[model samples]
Target: MNNNKILDVAIVGYGPVGQTLAILLGRMGYNVAVYERWQALYPLPRAVFHDHEIRRVFRMMGLENELEKVSQPSACYQWFNADWKVLVEIDWSAESISDGPFGYLFNQPSLEAILDRQAKAIGNVQVHQGWEVLGLSQNDATCELNMRKVEGDGAGETRTVQAKYVIGADGANSIVRRECGIEWHDLGFDEDWLVVDLQPNAGVELDVPDIGQWCNPARPTTMVPGGPGYRRWEFMRLPHESVEDLQSTEKVWQLLSPWVTPETASLVRHAVYKFRSRIAEHWQQGRILLAGDAAHLMPPFMGQGMCSGIRDAWNLSWRLDLVLKGICSEELLNNYTTERKPQIQAVIEASMAMGKVVCVADPQAAAERDAKFLSGQVPPLPPFPGLEQGLVFKTAKAGVSGSLGIHGAIERNDKVERFDDAFGRGFFLLSIGEDPLQSLDEKLLGELNQLGVRSVRLSKDGAPGTCRDVSGKYHQFFEENQLQAVLVRPDFYLYGGVSTHSEIPALVQSLCDEVSLKREPCAQLSQAKVAVR
Candidate 1:
């Protein structure tokens, strides 16, 4: 048995969530170790869609160009009845605060390949494939993982590794979550469905609705783009059919015959998936934490299954980074579940609501649903939830805290580009007409710098030390919200905002308190109303 050196972070799965965390932390120069039982990336397609928020995350990793080549923007999502009458339409092409298309469709394998290459390119990230984690134990100081090689030379060799924190991004059947004695809280949604992936042949363009759902009671189905060169269809398994019978090649062909044939398109893969809605009771226990599918699982109705997991990684990365740097205590991790669970729960409920609408198997119920939609009585889809609590500033006034911050084109150093590209990614103290740092005292300024908070002044006049808001988005945001200074977290969420620049120091001071930055109390300001939301 060999004992490996302690790592700053240990990831137990090599899926996109784990890979994302590795890349984010490794780029920050943290020593990250990733363990996976598989020797190579999964070749089959799984998740096929990601929203603009995820696009922003990938852009932060400098994968914008690479992702563009393999992805196609989603124009819209439509749901239709058996008669082909449109019941609902979601505009996925609408502009988002992330400054891009609302959603995108791409091949999961290609995306994983891109993330794999990026993760390996970072010298600080050590990816250990073919290593199966058999057991895990965590003390107050560190977590230890017991594992053995499952493939290649010295396959039977066992080793123990240590990490300050361990994250389980290992799929639904997660070993890390099990070891921590965490139980799942089932949200009462489970249904079996057959998923089929196809690649059309040359010059073959089958006639079908692009990204629409056929909500027919006889055979509820879903048709959408799988990626650049692929298409996917899903059929809800009727009660009369067995899962085994639905997955057969003959049945698959029959289900796909309406739109494609053996010559028009080639079958890539087909399987029956039991869409479930479940969330773990706890996401963290001691130094062991859960992320991605390990933390929550929802039906694929909204296509946020993978997106939600990536959000978990993004939320955890910064908190872990702060803890590893000793800038914050481990107690800061308590906010992990506090901030993410509610949003994920809301998503699960929404997806389940959609599933109920689409998975109707009765003739009368389907007719009623269609009539309600046709009558315009059905309500619109609920907006996606944001951070309503935990580590965010609360004010008596209606503030922009817990909302996603805006991003737009800005001109800096005679070059025009996206806000992130122009100023870089981190905690940003953005002021509209003046320098936000000027209000901060030396102590607060030093702490802000230590926290890697970047202060930027934006204006249309192009004054010295201020970037030009080329797109006028910054001006609009500040004006609409009646805010002069805004504090944005690394995840692009607004911590809080102030209507005046003098309150900037108070906002910064509140942040210092929230993040557990040890500093002496500065003189109080009358307008400073910083409390946790």
Candidate 2:
């Protein structure tokens, strides 16, 4: 750890969120240092689900092909009652607007390993495994991290590293969060559950549930398929069950008796976890920020525990890039906490709601709840919430800003590929009809060019320098929404949109002002289009 040079960012805890942020920053050509107390990946599986929106992020990292190797597309998530009657079913296999499956099932260790490998490959990212963060403090110029090497050659040695900014991606019981004086705002839902992961014995024959919720009052349990030949079961701790009692190996097998015995399966790992729902009162303080489990914790009923953390990383990456590159003010980073807190809070509430459904204990209460759901009076599933506030421009020509941007396969060269792969990353100006550049004045175009924004003209048929919307969804999205052009952020969220070509310049200027783009550039801005063909 070099103490003299001022690094761009220092990340505490090199879990998935920390690694993702490190990789994103490294790819953007920033100097990053990640400190992890643990020298290796946590061998147990924790999170198991991610949606298409997250898949798009993986696509942004250029890891879609690698991700497919470790993930399995999930089927519908169906809930059943004591009598085996269906309560509510969420169809995860349904196609999303992003032109992919609604969700995916994966092992957390595999996902983290993929992120770690990619992050280490980046030229500027340095991983300090076995280095434990001891304390954090910030002066006017930089934040200083005090760390000690916990293992290997430097076992008991202490050192200091300096960075312009520091982020805490440490898990729950985060030292960084505590050092920043952030408190937890508990959502009040807590339960003790046994999480058991196992692989079936060779040639074991038995009918097992595939990703089903058994809501029986006798024992409310969840069985989920984890990739190929792997299964997970979560059994809720009953009223009479004690944490100590449930932790015994003999007792654990008893809970698994209904599903499998030691004869029929090989026990991989089992642990008693008290699932908690909590979010930090403040996510950012001065030059320090918190992400992942350090910022929020949620029940895994929706499988969003890890997904929300990954979202935090992606949401902060671009903003940090703009600020570090001096394209935006440091105050812009405040949007991270402002924007992510509400979104993660919503996810926590929704997960708690689902937890209430699956954690029912009393027979009468479970029966009444199931009856209400079975009698065709069920509540509709909540629509995915968009950015409600912070940094989003809400008053575009069509009032469609703050919504998630759509993705589709584009025809380029002799291959069909994801839009991001063909168009590259960063701010994008996409038009459906005419070339959007024709509509922009030199001043607005110069502003966009100076900000490193790319312009793409999309058409149904191939044109010189224009991308072909092979899926036809991008064109249909424009037609259905009555939008001629849209400005999309790097994280695939709508910055703003214009209904007519004439409104393009104004939209560009609005975005320029919102992002605080510089008027001058190192070189004069040019009227150049990104060559896709």
Candidate 3:
């Protein structure tokens, strides 16, 4: 064996995003390292709003069952005004598909803890908590890095490392972005806010079950249940008013006094922050890249800030895995930033719009905005437009050529990674039970196994009537639900399918050039099922 080495990946700045990228790539058998500035973890609840793709990440990481334990079943939600007037009190349990409104609410610390533990569990990720990246640059061959332990009262020692690629998941003030000369567009957030998380009283009167929001013009509050009696109420600070002396218990009680008795509210985590919107002009330069808060920063209006970064992790994870495995050309990795940037920008715009509506304290604007929805002129916000739902995105820039329109932007994460017997390649296809990876001929199945294609045949357990599998595929029971097996590609796209078993190999070949997948599928596709549904 040649002693000389080829660098796989080096991830700079080991926060949640960096850590997540390391874990994801490590799972795909890529060599990864996470460099962090802090010697220890930050004990703050940085992110709270957990969404759909987040749940999918947990599922992919084999932590879904564990996450389901701490996860409180948040089904009922109420959108009310200061007068306790109901506007949109949606029982999320009713809407589980397409846009599954019912999800979990855990602080960023808890979620990060899970990801960190899982990354350690992968056993391949080397973590350097106190090491700060000195600098980075890349060429066509590989990327280089400089590092040192954060300086103490004495002086810090220096170190150097190299890798094939570098991901800068550092926060908004990213050093790697500076190295790459990446520009960012700023959405002015001259206004700032205070978040006062408090506990609820025993006999407080409100119709909200677990998660609720007070959408009053003055002092809007969101009641997010953390655990048993503790609830979070994020209060937007008024103009010219900084959250001075907010750490004191008295001040917290005073700010929340209008809503409830001071004795009833307990201040758990209280702080102030200026909300801003910014997306990095470019996400990658040569082998150096950026992710998470480093690439895009959005206000916490919809709680998708970290969620969007997690989405980035999901998108880039498999692609990097493919390149490292020599399954896909490294050029395909260039599509990583291309595919994700526009989507994240759209998310930022949506979040900014939501912030305007949610933070509108002016009576006239609030009434006009709320009245349209109250009067039923416009439908209640569809719980964040999703891939399956109607999606609108920002147009691509000049030279960003492709036949695929915004669909590529919105639907990128829609495809599932199914893992079963026939599938090879480290990534799973994520299929439904009914369309379980069809029992192919032994020779073909063995060939896939030899090629090491990782696949899964999911049986949607306890799915009522008929439902799609985890891979967004159809199984034997798919007829009732109008689904056939959706063949999800390694990059997590619906590669074809919606037909049946035997027919998959041909369909797979056309979608991904991994193997000799034929065009003519063996399984018969039901046309009547399509027309009926």
Candidate 4:
């Protein structure tokens, strides 16, 4: 091992979250590496489901399309009364959501394989198999990591690696979380469950991949679909039942009972484990930090354990890009936990609510769970100001438009024209007239463009413009104070405006420049648009 080599980031695990984070940063031109304890893809059927955010993370790795190829088609999660009567079916489909992709049910190992391949192909990512990280320490500028090759019987030598930052993507029993000296504030109700993974004979249809959750307060089972014609069932163990003892063929058959027939199913795998809901006390401390199970581990009730971590990856990735690339201040990075903590806290609470409602055993508790399920009570989705659907960006007519650019609901099948001219995936500028922005000269505009300054103009809405997405409503909002266009960020935070083509560069700089300068948090820039742009 080259102990003295340095990387832009050092990831502590190579599961789904770690591998995806590595490939994401590596593709962004950052030097990255992984310390993985697993020498190879281990036992299958670990993680069975992932939510929409996972889809977004996979897309960042350029695998969203590929995933659909191998992903199983699943749509509904149905509640059941132990006797097999269906209660309520919650349908999840991503045909209209912006972030894209609803959710999927597939074996975790396969997903990891796909991400691992991408990590290995990247020249900027170096992954070490069977390397157990011993400990780490970091200042603001860099980090030092200690590790030993676990695969070797006596390879006990520790190597030191220099890294600008470290992510703890290990499992719940994370050494990184431990070394950080943080603890989880628990949500109660720890219980044991037995997971049975088996192959069904061709033409056998017992339980649909459409997860059937038995919330009868009687017995709750979460059924998930494995890729390519396979399914697994997770059932809570009755008090005093031992999955270790159930490892016997007869015992396994007993557990598989009710769901599979003796002749229709063949046992492929089974495991027993218990878990509780938890969140990391601290997501980041200094240059060393945490993500995924290292940060939060809720029960798999919502099937969001791994997906939540993936969300952390995407959130952290863009901020890391800004900071590492000299576009933002590190204090803005502090908002990482700020933005994500609330979201994860919600996940933990929701998962806990699920455990309490669905895992009912007592008659009274079961009745309450059943009453809640039957009453058709659905929790409200978290409110985010950025998520309201509509033509989000209105053209602040930088002293150009007759009215605030038109803002309205984008109709289905509406042609968005060309988004290439619009600012996107970053803060950009737009122009409506022929005027050169007043704030910047041609030379300055050229420099801003070199620094990734983006601007565009449409003499009219139908003409050449940056309407990158037409399915989405891109309303025209016109403002008199601004120039001919507007600039928006990836997160859709309003950054600045262009009063003239010349002013576009300075507007972009004003919104993003100070983060790279000396400061903790960047000053907020606000913008106003007309009724429609």
Best by lDDT: 1
lDDT of 2: 0.85
Over 4 Å off, model 2: 397-399, 463-465, 520-524, 529-533
lDDT of each: 0.89, 0.85, 0.60, 0.64
Residue 29 displacement in candidate 2 (angstroms): 2.0
lDDT of the structure predicted as candidate 4: 0.64
- lDDT per residue for candidate 1 within 322-417, as digits (tens), equals 888887777779889988999899999999999999999999999999999999999999788888878888771364888888898988888989
How accurate locally is residue 106 in candidate 1, as Cα lDDT from 0 to 100?
A: 98
Each model's TM-score? 0.95, 0.95, 0.75, 0.78
Tens-place lDDT digits, model 3, residues 411-515: 112333333212322433334444334544444444444334445434455242222244332343245434334444343333334345544554434334433
Position 352, candidate 1: lDDT = 98
Sorting all predicted structures by TM-score, with the top scorer first, yields 1, 2, 4, 3
Off by over 4 Å in 3: 1-7, 90-101, 151-155, 187-190, 198-209, 227-229, 243-249, 258-266, 382-485, 490-493, 496-509, 513-533
Task: Return the TM-score for candidate 2, rounded to 2 decimals.
Answer: 0.95
What is the C-alpha lDDT profile of model 4 across 1-533, one tens digit per residue?
A: 55677788899988888887888889889999898887776757678777654554465356866787667645777667655666666565533233434567776667777887888999988988878878777775898888888785556666888898888898888888888797887767587877878878999987454677776444567777776567787778765566566557787677678778679977778877686787777788888778988888788777778777877776677678877887556765675675567667777777776676667777676666556656767554342222111112233332321111222222122444224222224434555565333455444454444335455434433443323223332323434353456654443334445455665555555544533433334333212111112
